[model samples]
Target: MTTFVTLTAYGLADGAVLALAALGFVLIYKATAVINFAQGEFLLVGAYTFYSSFVIFGLPVTVSVLNGVAIAVILGVAVERFVLRPLIGRSPISVIMVTIGLSAILTAIMQLIFGTEARAMPPVLPRGSIEILGATLPVQRLLVVVVAAVVLTAFTLFFRYSRHGVAMRAVADDQQAALTMGISVRRVFAMAWALAAVSALIAGVLLADITAVDPHIATFGLLVFPVVILGGLDSVPGTIVGGLTIGLIKMYTFGYLDPGLADVIPYIVLVLILLVRPYGLFGETRIERV
Candidate 1:
């Protein structure tokens, strides 16, 4: 049916972006055991940076994109080195609270610098639409899916075979063992944050293309919590599955029910999944002795 095809297209595009964002959450958690409450703020900063460089400043798309990504990477490294590194042995709750405070700081800074207005970017993708069944799908949406797929594939290869990727995996598995093997745990932590920022930057650009750039864009990062949690916070592949499932559920709600309820659906699913599987469907269960 036309509705089915239309929903499917939107779902896949949205899901891909969500998966990208959620991957960042998983990477940081797996690598350093710190929940980055500021993940969404990374997206906010990247989107605004791109807007300033490309739209307001009139730079070339490639240059602006690189600038945005560079800013994200630098911020990630700086946060790790200055804000979090000192708290290395602190309680998880303390680190989590620090990230929460960091999020507030980042949000305040973004609002102060960018203001609260939404800024439209000049269309970078070819402006067009494709017909799917009886419904029309935007070429931009299709491009989002393609870009996400490429990034996912590239990262999969990187993690499976690359030296740095292997190091990260080892560090995640057991930090003490990795350190004993001569791996720089601090370096790995920094790299995880940097990669997470890169992923957030990509998601920010894609989502900004769909919904314009604004302070509210950062809230999309918050949405990733449900995706990561539903998929298993520590499971990368699960992020993809959770994203797709969330997207489909959202689209189904919009198509069959009220469009206004779309935003509420993800959290609803999150709650249900939490109730059913506290560790997530693909997440590993660790037994801690009291």
Candidate 2:
């Protein structure tokens, strides 16, 4: 019972981070019709940015977080403006390859800037444990879940009511119609990238706080694929559900099943989901007639 409680708590935290990363991926895909392979690099760069600011420069924690956000916005916009914007209307294969190339380049740059050594994440969250249902749960994990929920809620509201958010949604639904309606598709695209980066930045920081500041954080971003796939690539609400579900599955696998299975379970679920429902739980289905 204690073990179950602990695993559930940790799983929620993991799901929260996954949701953030997957949110970014879904945003870019929905708005720009592009699957950004560099999305994981966004997490990599953001985590290191925070690490560099606090550990290396000794900045205030608040300032360090803001710095991470700044870098994310800059990196996101720069990628969209310089690399992706020009490739608009090109072959999908070309765009996909370019994004893959971008990921490699970003990875290289990160390694060049910070050697491949793993480092401790700044212990920012409160350190302690709380007794819940006779189980001692880490405060950090609970805080992670809370923080992620708040951020995700804020984003949900932003998308629901904000003007720019509406515009982005409009563009996502139908780019041609949005363009005809006087919406700037280009700006929407840029905003999508920037927002995605920011979400990944926050997720990167949270996950690093739980684990460590390591190169593997970037690879962890790949997990977003399964989350988004499970939740529905273009469904915002689906991302959250998918993330939490996957997180719980992983934790349960780690606790009760073969621990090795935890790492691979999400992908396996992804494959099964594809076979059963290719559109995902909330994803829209489109039919075209020639």
Candidate 3:
């Protein structure tokens, strides 16, 4: 029972990371209809930026985190203004291809600048364990869960009540209508990118704690796809629930299934979900009028 509890806690932590990353994915897709193949690269960049600022420069961890997030926001805005904005109203395939190209370019640039070697992230949380219900878990893991929850909650509230947040939702729903209503669709796109960047930063930092920083960090962004799909691309709460579901599924795979099954479980689940609930558990269904 204790083992199960421990695994559940760890799974929630992992899910939190997935949920946060997927939130960004959903945001960009919702607003701009871009899949953002480079999403993971943004995360990699943020992790490396944090490493450089804190681990290498010896700056305070808090300061480094702030700087890292700032860089991510700038990168997001730049990408939208330069790369994605130019392709607006173009073919979806073209936009997707551009994102793929952008991913490769970002990866190459980072490789040249940071090199291919894995770098370590400085520990942000205290190194210790907390006991709950007779289960011992790392303090950092709990922190990850708490931080993810807080971030997700804050974003939910922002989108629910804030003016800009409402504007974003309007843009996501119908860009043309949003524009007619005096909302700046372009600015909303940029803000979506900025928010995505921040999500990547948080994911990168938390993931860096568990995995070393390297080019492969970008791959972690891919994990967001299944979560987003499960939650429904347009549903934020669905994303959170989907993330937790996938996390628990992964944990069970690691525990009961063949050790190698962990890698395949997500795809399997994704396929099943698509077959059963094409729009996702909480995703809004589209109605077309001819």
Highest lDDT scorer: 2
Better candidate by TM-score, 1 or 2? 2
- Expressed as tens digits, the lDDT of each residue in 5-123 for candidate 2 is 99999999999999999999999999998988888888998888999998999999999999988888888899999999999889999999999999999889989999899889769
61-124, model 1: which lDDT tens digit per residue? 9999899889989999999999999998889899999999998999899899888888888897
Candidate 1 clashes between residue pairs 3 or more apart in a chain or in different chains: none
Which regions of candidate 3 are displaced past 4 Å?
none
Candidate no. 1 TM-score: 0.97
RMSD of each predicted structure: 1.2, 0.9, 1.3
User: Which candidate ranks first by TM-score, i.e. highest?
Assistant: 2
Between 1 and 3, whose TM-score is larger?
A: 1
Cα shift from native, residue 140, model 3 (Å): 0.8
Task: Arrange candidates, best lDDT first.
Answer: 2, 1, 3
What is the Cα-based TM-score of model 2?
A: 0.98
Ranking of all predicted structures according to TM-score, beginning with the best and ending with the worst: 2, 1, 3
Candidate 3, residues 1-290: lDDT per residue as tens digits? 77788888888988998898888888998888889888888888888888888888999988988999899899999999999888877999999999899889988998999899988765786669989889898888888889999999999999999999999999988888999999998999999999999998988888888767888988877878789889998888998999999988888788777769977898788999899998999999998999
CA deviation > 4 Å runs, candidate 2 = none
> Candidate 3 at residue 31, lDDT?
88
